[model samples]
Target: MRSLRLAAATVACLSAVALLSACDPEGTDTGDSAASGAPSAVPSTPAAAKSPAAKSPAAKTSATPAATSPATPGKAGRLPAGVWVDPKAVPLNAALHWRAPGPAKVLGEQGKLQIETLCHTRRDEYHAEVAMVETASLGGASGDWKADETIASYGSGADSSGVIQTTYALMGVFAQGVKDCAATAPGAKVTVVAEDVDHLFADVTLPQADGSTVVVHEFLVSNRGSIAELTLRADLPAGARPKTAWTAPADRQALSDALGKPACTAFKDCV
Candidate 1:
């Protein structure tokens, strides 16, 4: 497939007080490496509904932030045949510790959303996996933040070579989504902070009406045929923006790396 759009949340999580979020996108289905945002378009999930980086509808979550779980290596999980992630089994490593987890809602049989890349016009192309889940906490103060994580699994039947090809094709989708975002959002500064072959991190700052700004950082990583996304959405008040406001968080890289840990043994052989 070809040509992708990073549309807003289809069943995406919405929250102004969320620091982190997990979204499945819904957009163009022309597969093979697309955009990267926060919704569940089969091709992408990096931004929001209205603007390229607008406020998406967050998945249901707990009111308070969950405590950080202890990091444990080798805690890497196993991939059971045709089985997705187990909310109860996902261990909390120093790298991935979203203490508070919301209910996991799967979307894909209906249609997967796209994760737009490039920040220019909010148009991105990121091909997603089979099952997609968007999640996040809702309702909170402006200064506070919430978080969520979305993962796309290609399933036990995916070929490693195909998964590798898809990952390679999507190398620059997130960076492109940043450019697309800047094209539309006024005074909005969206930039790719860090990236590698299988992962990307970007920061988006949008000026608000009351002299405030919402800074969102999205981190995505791919393994085999799976993509795990960790996003941070924060509302910074005027005169309170820190110098590090536009930079990737200290643990973003680590968090992203730990996402596809202990590769599910199921992917070792993709004949």
Candidate 2:
């Protein structure tokens, strides 16, 4: 009976040990599965978007701006007809007078005269000087009229002041020696007209060939000596085309440089 009892106790101990081993294995496997599954949940976390910030350098490159174009020429405004100065219109020191033969009546009495000095020309071919003459057209298109006349100095300003001659068939004041300028080429004539003249700007209009008007602004220059440096610009009526034979390069840069600004090619890129 004693031997049987001892054998029974040993059998019980063996069974308990087997059960414990089975439970330990199950617990270890469960722990390993939970640890493995944790990595997948990390991808769904809000912190996942932090990766984009780490690559931020590429984002800034696309935001940079492009270069801009320079301002167009003849942008200031149109010229004022007659003299730029009314008080000092005609020169007090300089003795001056004018004459035109054959029923050319003087329209307005030369009063409150104004003269803005223009000292440069587009081409280096000739030294240029100009004065805005205060007068009107007597004969030609209109019978008797009041208009601004431009007195361009082509012959030597040093010459005795009197009737000067010009090749240009201009009704207003023109250079006296355009014919002399044409020695290089006969039948070559240059006519400059004031399409608009004002102290400031509105819309600038250019005449088109198809009886239409295109608005374009032009720039001008002024000098330290108000009398010495000046720029000319105009705004023509819409649908009025420039005469085919009459187009001039708006040599603003050359004139501006000769007056006070930086130099550039005349009439081409400046505009």
Candidate 3:
């Protein structure tokens, strides 16, 4: 009986060891699996370990601006005609006279003035005259009068010495016209005495049947498309010559300086 009891106790000890081995396959007592009901020995998948609540990137929105049209030229405003002429620049003894019937004529971005007379001294013994006309155009048609033809005809040829040939050709044509006038009216001779880049000075000699000589001085100037024609005439007792040669150069320069300002200044579109 004592031997049988001892054998029974040994059997009980072997069964307990087998049960512990089944719970822990490695036969080691790592507290991780023993403390928790889950099998901590098996590792989780990589995808399952990631955070399920992580957010995705937001969608992009277009931020480009709309296209616009290009601006047009000469849209600002038109210049004034009076700005091209200053009456104060005329001779002190001269009077301000308007050749145009009305005020300055404005068309689109252009302006025009008919004629302005500074002095028209007409006496039995002497005669004098000074006149001016101005025209401004911004890409439109030219003035009604054909003054541009004369301006265009100038500087059209080349010179071997690089010196610009003055308006001698035009002056010759004008002299012919004066001769034609004299043929009808009698005793009139117009001669182009001097010419430069911007001016033509002429001497008109009229031989009256009474032996007195009528001498007239004429000057034509072009500045920035503006034209000014000045005339001074005096009747000599007999055989007297004109003294305008000495002062013609200085007078022409002064008139040129007076009209040198750009006509576009008065116009917004011109700017």
**Candidate number of the best TM-score:** 1
Model 1 lDDT tens row, 55-165: 211111011111011112242222232222323223222233335444544453222222342222331223332323343332123454434455554433243344345
lDDT of 2 by residue, 1-271 (tens): 9999999999999999976654334444334535455422234555534544322211211121100111123521112232222211211101211122122122221211112122111222112222221222212111111112222211111121211111121111222222122333232233333322211111223344554443222222222111111212222455343322222335533433432211112111111
Residue-by-residue lDDT tens digits, candidate 3, 1-271: 9999999999999999977855666667757665666674877765523744212100000010100111113422222333443543433213222132124233321111111111111111110110112232211111111111111111111221111122233233333343343554466666776666555566666677788765555555543322334444455567554332223434656764544332323222121
TM-score, per-candidate, Cα-based: 0.49, 0.18, 0.31
Per-candidate Cα lDDT values, in order, are 0.44, 0.25, 0.36
* Model 2 error, position 257 (Å): 4.6
Report the number of backbone clashes for model 1: 80
Q: How close is candidate 1 to the true structure, as a TM-score?
A: 0.49
Task: Write the number of the candidate with greater TM-score, choosing between 1 and 3.
Answer: 1
